[model samples]
Target chain A: MDSVRALTLIVTMAFLVLAMPAEVALGHGVELSVAPHESIEVNAAYEAGEPMAGAQVAVFAPGEPAEPWLRGSVDEEGRFFFVPDSDRPGTWEVQVRQAGHGGIVRIEVEPAGVVEVTGGGLTPLQKALMAACVLWGSIGTALYFKRRAV
Target chain B: MIGIRTTRMVVLLVTLLAGILTFAGCAAEGAPEPETPAPAAETSDTGLLVFAADGEEHAREGTVSKEGWNITFEHAYVTLADIAAYQTDPPYDVDADGWDLAYDHMVSLPGEFTIDLADPASDPAILGEVADAPAGFYNAFSWHMVRAASGPAEGNSIVFIGTAEKDGETVDFTLRFDQELAYQGGEYIGDVRKGILDAGGEAEAEMTFHFDHFFGRADKDADDPLNTDALGFDPLAALATDGVVDVSLGDLKESLSAEDYARLEDILVHFGHIGENHCIAEPLE
Candidate 1:
């Protein structure tokens, strides 16, 4: 009777072990790690200093200015963050709009993760004036030399 | 012999001076050639760019003014000229650049277009289109509101013939503006993006006008800047005579209160827009 009872107990234990999930029986575990990356952050606000909270945001890449590279909305603090594709390097345009008021900003991204906020460099009139100055300088130099030679 | 020698020397000096001037002229002309950069890319790929003007639902569906007047338009005529679209490498920022738009490429629609904003058929009247426009994103737009040469809106840059009603009183108004105004704007700010033309594809660039900027909106808070800055219908209604108000800028200058007149002029300057985006407006001089 003792021998028969021991055999029954062993069989029950074997059934329980067989029914257990593979992962649970194996005692699987997870691991985590962290790394550093580059990103861009922008803040939008009204002229009166009020935050444009929940504003629509659109990011245009240099290669495809016609299509939005990324679309999102600003946080309650009117802050937005994005990591541009480093492969595409050139002018990146970000537009933020809330209600009927909004504006666009430009960021120059280098191939090496360098980001720069650029401003309007020169107007056409300014460029023309600069060209005129160079032309005049060349002419004046030539005339001065000619007069001296004469 | 001395006189002969002097003449020879004078002639030699003159010849030398002429030669030097010619050389200087040539140098001046050639110096700027290298400064002008060639276009970044050129392709045979082309598309159609349709230039459109929108008055928005405020004109088509009618709107209630901040002053409680429900206004409906019969005819809203705007005569437009020199409508142009541009593609700027860095993209144009109206706030930063104002009227100074530096463009890499530009497409223009020739001739003057007098469009009726209240036309039930077309909410945004099609001003014109440019065929074979280089496929690109046109990020900047500029146009002039000039007096129509001969049309329903002749002798005026803009004509608004409409009806305004408030509290049992109704007023039919015809407000004409002859001020030649120029508007320079950046990208369109609306639900969907605009001005993106692909190779062999069609695209549109819009010239949007917000009448709510002039009349104010009842839907928005009265304290809202748009409403506060607006020259509401109340002021114009006060200038009505026998249930009608037909006035021009000149007429309003004489009839409306000085403060109200100044506000109206300021409102006119703020009238032009690109979707919800405001533009830099200047007299077309």
Candidate 2:
């Protein structure tokens, strides 16, 4: 009876060893998608090409409360929609966590007909001033040396 | 004569052009109206410092004997500070007891200089030129003697190294002075001194340190002596020739005689100043 019990235990251990890899592979497959609209729509999925339904998500914006600007779970199709406050502009941070893994992404809010001045390019006034200084220096140097030689 | 006149004409033209350009530059920058210019007058300026070993002009590299030992100075560098103000005549007197020169309103040159006292052909090292300096007769002036920051004697300000021979015995001696010459109000005084400086004209101060003046006298008690007696033999001079004596004063303190040690201390403190008749201010021409 003791030998039979030991054989049964060995069989059960082999079965568990063979099953662990498949479980890990299934858990690791994650994908995210967002749809563009007046309100942002977020979508998450796994590598098996299946939607990750009910995955938790949080959103934050500049000057928003620390306790997540918004929090919810993905819908049946692994998607969520967020309508940012009308006053909110600039960058929005979104965090998604499910099971044992998590990730974050940023969204930018730029209005139409608005432009940013990076200040990396030179202005017309600055270019003119530089040219004038170079010309003045060249003339002064040539005349001074000519006078000295004579 | 024609060349000289042409050069003068060119100089005047350049000056006029420079004046116009200066005004134009200020106007372009939207500067306010220019202030009234000062009246034409003479100004006292520090032009240069002339070095001589003894009374012989430009004799920087030579030997002088004290008692029986030969002495030579290889390098001498110093810094000159601004002159103290005197509201009344007979401006200030030298205080022999201690440093009583008021340090207030003292101005210093930008960088310390090592004048080439060993080269007779070399022009005196530049001290500084002050264009806006006051023009007048200065009663007295003060300066500082400092150690070199780098080179052979890296930290030493005064280096006098040479060979001394006596009684058919020759020995090497070195006096690497690291002590700073602090400015005292009345130390190293020159007599009947009046330096006239003119405005826009170059002038320089000449300070000649007579190496011969240092050796013949020794006083055992004073830190600095106003004068040294020729009759008294300075022990430092004797020790340089004698193998039994050491040149490092700090380590060989017990080996030196009381009088020799005192004289060495005095020389260390007061030997570098521009002594009487040795310092002067004159026009650059």
Candidate 3:
């Protein structure tokens, strides 16, 4: 009875395996496309596609392969966008990796040439001043003109 | 006269001040800075739209046009190894069912280019209407389908990739798939059955049909010029990756001339779809 039972189990296992289609899991998928010149700020990352989150980005100049030109983390949108050439020139390759993960994506970075972030990020005070100038100037001029008309 | 001039000056100054304030407030709202000959960057309005069907992202389109149909397909279950770039896996795995799909389209949201539907017979329901897409999302409101033809109808599915610009501005563009057949139920297919039946009820077992995606200068750099063989986009070529796709396209491809085939293929190759796994079928009947 034991021998017969064992045979039955083996056959069932074989059959099930045969009936099942090959299941291939997708690895990390990355695409390389030229972002518009203005939206060139970007980051390249690599990670095992599973967890679907928490990947870090490291960009390096292609061929140089030593130190990364830029490094950062994948945002909530799984993206890391920085000025492509923070004002420098060289073919770059951005790679993203996360801790406790395996999967590396290497993408080509054509020379974006150069870019300089001249404007400091908006400061609250500066913003307020610009607003006041436009608002108050217009209001004051309008009042003065109205009074004259009257 | 001098007093009147002084008063007029006062009024103009007041108007200028008010206008400045209102405009400044708007500026404070953080509208995109006007284009200032941005340094040689890819493009700010430029972005990446990934069409993932089956289990992989086989094709990557860098840009899309707003005036015409932008399609993407992820041939999963179907044996489609010969279809596009990177024939790295078996065409289809029948055992594992999937959310695999064949196409995705992202028409520009704030489509501003006016298009003249040369065909008066186009479905009037969606004609000549400007679309308002929310910022940060594709907005040319659309409807898509993918139906089954063998035994019973299967539900087709579609999703908007993202919106983009047609020109620097807004306009209406219409395309029709009638005069041949329509693909609405997810408009996805996995076989060339249509081609077999078309070959005099013994169709060529290959699917063929015209595919169109109008382009501006930018799209030409992104699309497969080979698909636009006639270059002028004459009678478009019908293609088949499976017998079912062929069966569905009917004789529409035959309607196109060799010159037309040449023209379309020329333009399509620029967008990636090139070579034999994807072909311009001889109008066999």
Candidate 4:
């Protein structure tokens, strides 16, 4: 009877071990392509070692709109691309989610480079001073001429 | 005569006004405006980022095997391929076209450093330093990994030997991650931000590499999990005192099924640079 009990115990333990689930490593990653004033491209993937298609994507800008600035999904190759509005120039937070897994990437857009037009002209201050000089000269001449005549 | 004198005074005043206007215009056009101030020169190092290998200090050392299995390494090493700096702020031009901008701020070790992932106190190697990093902060860093060849520690980039025991039976095997795949032509890790590396002052950071995640289960696609069950014997178990299962890095193609090779390749490509905090800087903490 004891031998039978031991055998039953061993069989039960083996069945339980076999029933245990396999250890699948949860792997998810993201890649980004960003440039000044250009569309930001992102690629996301899961552990099957393939691109994550149809993943939801959301973008957050610097200001209001507690809601996301842009929303979309990844294409067949698991890629998403979008251009930020011209007005929004700063750090943009991008979040991608799918199948209970997600990742975020922060992209920074620079303010446009400005080209100054010096044109080699007088500044506003210089122009104002020149006008004042002309007025003073005209008034002094009138007073001198009137005084001399009297 | 008085009218004539008045006329003469009027003409003189008009002439004087015109002369003054002309002189002012000339001065405005000729004199250059004061130029904007250049950023201050970078002096002194406040932040330092160092690379290390250990179980505790350098690589992930110890008997941290999965349930019902044990793994050990006879020799494990990874040759660093390239480490470059990226601008943390706008214009985010990676490596600044060349090192001259952010890459060459402070001189770095010219060649690669071969490190053992088993040792805990393997002295950390220096990558690069910031001189007078630009006015804005350097918020991000990126690196690439390459298989080592033509180095003192020749042969495979990674080598492993171990054994696993389960259900009252033990098996031995060997594994090697020698082949380096061309992901976008090279194994490139993306930009990672730790913290700010200011222009001046000594800010030190250290990075350690962890290895167990390479063998973790890949995400599931079907009803049951995949790549989680091990072979009858342990492929990573070290060689026995006499002779045991010896599986070299190049033997995977013939010894394992195509699905297994593909899975291994996936682990190779996505070797967890950001995930599992393998290539992380200490300043982040």
What does chain B score (TM) in every candidate?
0.83, 0.56, 0.21, 0.54
User: Candidate 1 or 2, higher DockQ?
Assistant: 1
lDDT of 3 at B185: 14
The model with the greatest DockQ is: 1
List residue ranges in candidate 1 displaced over 4 A. Answer: A1-39, A85-88, A111-114, A119-150, B1-43
Residue-wise C-alpha lDDT for candidate 4, range A15-108, written one tens digit per residue: 0112222333334643333222234455555434355578677776755323578788888877777666657676665555543234454544
List, residue by residue over B196-242, the lDDT tens digit for candidate 2.
33444433334435444444312222221222322122355455544
Q: How accurate locally is residue B241 in candidate 2, as Cα lDDT from 0 to 100?
A: 44
lDDT of 2 at A37: 26
Q: How do the residues A1-150 of candidate 3 rate in per-residue lDDT, one tens digit apiece?
A: 111000000000000112222343446664433322322333222211122245555555544444566666666645555444434454444444332121222222334322121111123453354445434534554564586479
Pairs with steric clashes in candidate 1: none
lDDT of 4 at A72: 88
Interface DockQ per candidate = 0.10, 0.00, 0.01, 0.02
Off by over 4 Å in 3: A1-59, A62-150, B1-250, B265-285
Instruction: Note the clash tally of each candidate.
Output: 0, 10, 107, 27
Ranking of predictions according to DockQ: 1, 4, 3, 2
Ranking 1 against 3 by DockQ, winner = 1
For model 2, the stretches where C-alpha displacement exceeds 4 angstroms are A1-150, B1-63, B76-90, B95-107, B121-125, B166-168, B185-194, B217-246, B252-254, B275-285
Q: What local distance difference test score does each model get?
A: 0.75, 0.42, 0.27, 0.42
